[model samples]
Target chain A: MKKNITPYLFAAPAFLVLGYFSILPMLQTAYYSTLEYSFFGPHRFIGAANYVRLFTDPHFWATLLNSLLFLSVTPVLMVVSLTLALSVRNLLRGARIVRLMLFLPVVTPVVIAGIVWRWIFTEETGLLNHLLSLASVGPVRWLTEFPTNLVSAMLVTVWRGMGYYMMLFLAGLALVPREVEEAGILDGATPLQQVWHVLLPLLRPTLLFVAVVSSSAAVKVFTEQYILIPGAPLDNKALVSFLYRHAFERFDFGYGSAAGMVLFGMTLLFSYTQVRLMDREQSS
Target chain B: MRKALSRIVIITASAAAVIPFLWLAATSVKGAEELFVYPPTFIPRTFQWENYTGVWNAIPFGLYLVNSLTVALLSVVFNLLLSSLAGFALARYRFRYRGLLFGAVLFSMMVPKEMLVIPLFTSVLRLHLADSLLGVVLPFAVEGMGIFLMRQAFLALPRDVEEAAVMDGAAPLRLWWSVMLPMVRPSLAALAIFTFIGSWGDFLWPMVVLKSQEHYTVQVGLSMMLGTFVDNYRYVAAGSLLALLPVALLFILMQRHFERGLLSGSGK
Candidate 1:
């Protein structure tokens, strides 16, 4: 029997790239977290000092809270996206165009969307304020203030994300057999009840997938905040934004890596659940 | 009543989703004086068509576009080449440690790039690739999502086709190149589009790795320019819209493949 070396040869380049780029860098992050290191400064051993500073810092907690606040959008996104999907499914006309319009934001680069939204959210002469004035509401400092800015950023995520998630739900809804809905109708279920019992139950797997994906994305939220708010202070930063600021902006590699490790742990948990969900999907 | 209500809901949602893009298009062509009006007009009285051309000169947008194109194209080429080879090996051959290797690929897929940025930056720096185009492209040249998609594509093919090729004395490489790859053309298209979008729209890594204006990709360059022109943002609007044009065009022309790529990419 010939021992075929073809497979190994074929697989070598990919493994090398992944090893150096993905696997090696992850392990290196863990090491960097332990050292008081920066690109320009000499590496000094700092046993848990960075972690101590991070834990003690109120700003760190603020960023963590900001991340949790970001996660709050996941539920809103699910409801809005699912509603859009279900509504479009029932539409008798222009469903394809409607879906296209909804999905446009998903493909548009976040920076571009951020540019437009920033203009809209400008305080005095901004479009949003002008619209508010029609209802006699004074200009709300959307991007300039703290919590409003965060909420405004969340609005962009929801607007940009719902379309993609809606597509996921649309795919899921397509898989559901027609008979199930018919049976719900025979049982005299209201339109709302039909969704509650028939559609949502079968779409649970997709709901779980969306939940994990959206939450993981929320945890790593960067572009929206970075684009909309620009250089937000420590208190207003998302966890990843905090890590970016420290690592790249401040050049505090040690502190930044420690912050990054925390974010890594969080996203790893979400990714683990996602992988499990996907494996279940594949096997089923 | 129900149908009307649903139509209203969808229309409102679509408008919310798309109006920003329309506003951007309108704002991009507006002259400096036309901006910041109290009742912001939806359409420019006279379209500043030069704004589109001006974006290329206001910054080194041509340089950024080239940088972005090089990174995206190189990424697609390498990702397709390496991932398909690896995927073919995983799907077609039974080899030692195949499961472990496949598992490694899946594991790599799950770990977000942002989480690894600190070390990724340092590693690229150590290898003397930082602030170079290769530095931006190399780390993401072959992604887990590509390999996984290709592997799934290959696995879906029937075994008899490959068996007949093997019986005819075709070399494994030749068999893969001629027989297997052509059958997976749709998957390849899907993977290529995904890779192009990901690489072209990538911001954080490019921003971190690239230091000079000469190396900045469109997103990074436009971001810097936006900061520079905060009060007067017409140029930035034009610049961002230009950056979005290729992708918007891609999405329009290849909607089917884009949707396919996106649904498959739901895992990541």
Candidate 2:
């Protein structure tokens, strides 16, 4: 009899907090998305008007495009991180130190990464342009120019993300059977061929995991936009930053929640896929 | 020859990886004069350790550190207790709605934080938790990842010990405390370290809830300082380095466990 009730007692505390805070807020976000809501009240119900505004609004469209563009950076990120992972994972000695060095960026706070990277691309005395000048190249307006502003921010994301994804890939590599790689060599495969033919297939699960996780982060990135170019003209607003500007800056709660809902939908799509893939992996 | 090439590639990759830190360490120690040279030297010619002192005094940086530590500690404690309790329930006892409850937990994990910020802040505002450490820590205290990690840990425990204790008339809670908790130390350590590391560096939620400089986390303080220290890049760099010091140390000390925790939680 006591056993029958004990589990509920144990789970109740966490569920209570989660219910009141996390899950409830998601419902509130959806509810507020349909209304002219604020700290004061949800004064009026305007069904899908906020959604209509988002579809028609040029700013919304631009940020939506930027969200897609931001996510596109993941492929580049994966390639670079994979390359680094492969290189260091097979090292005979001091692999730990190399992995530690690479992983440093991941552990560093995002805002600090943002500020430091922003400084690195600063026009006059920043590191990148300083290095460029010694090669007799003129200073590029990395933070000031149109596409460069967005590109520089994307570069920072790739930098911060590489080590973390490298760690994931290394974890995957550890699970791959050694005999398979040796067999690839015995079949007279080149190193690149061994990777392409043998190791890459085994790494599919990790690749999917990285892709999904990276996509969610990429679409929802805020710190880079906030720190690098806070009011970074309409051209480069990621969805979360755009939501933040409206909800916090302009106090357009309805519009912001509408935008937030879209972010939620995108996250759901990715996470649902990830869960499906992961559950499949577990079953297999 | 291939080994040599791979080593060079690995070395160069690591060097590139640490370039920001290299630049940060160099820039933070540069005197005001040497900072704007036409092409700056990679190394600081003169070490200006005062940047650290200067930045620390420029604001209530110490207060930020204290507040961040407080929030992180509260988050760690809450997560440990709540997650372990929930984990034990899900992994041990059979209950009606157990599946539904666990599904809710999984679904809650799927909700991107951006979706919750507005309503969450409004709740924080209503409860008067706004501008307090509790507000910053409350939402994250019941983390899905921690619960999931704890559940996995609990599930892996051998059943015989629990069954033996139960047959001896041990109460559920008693068996949990006496027979189960000791065996899951590694997972608890992993959960606590990850929670501490995450809570310590979190910015977005804290940014929304916190309005006062007095309650700012280090991440918030750094961003806020960026606004005030446009010309004082060296100072900002120093502040950035100082903020990352503990995080780096923690990672170095628990590098293996951190990797294990991450891989077990996600990499499997």
lDDT of 1 at A55: 98
Candidate 1 chain B: worst 10 consecutive residues by lDDT?
Answer: B259-268
Clashing pairs in 1: none
The candidate that achieves the highest TM-score relative to the unseen native structure:
1
Binned by DockQ into CAPRI classes (incorrect, acceptable, medium, high), candidate 2 is medium
Q: Looking at candidate 2, what is the lDDT of residue A66?
A: 82
Q: Fill in the DockQ of model 1.
A: 0.70
lDDT of 1 by residue, B1-268 (tens): 7777787888789889888888898999999898988799888887998987888777788899899999999999999999999999999889988999989988987787887888888888889999999999999889887888888779879989999998999998999999999999988999988788878888899999999999999999988998787765888888888899888888888988878777765642
* TM-score of each model, paired residue for residue: 0.97, 0.96
Error of 1 at A85 (Å): 0.8
lDDT per residue (tens digit) for residues A161-243 in model 2: 88889888988898899998889889999988988878889999889899998898888988887898865686576788889
Candidate 1 Cα outliers beyond 4 Å, as residue runs: none
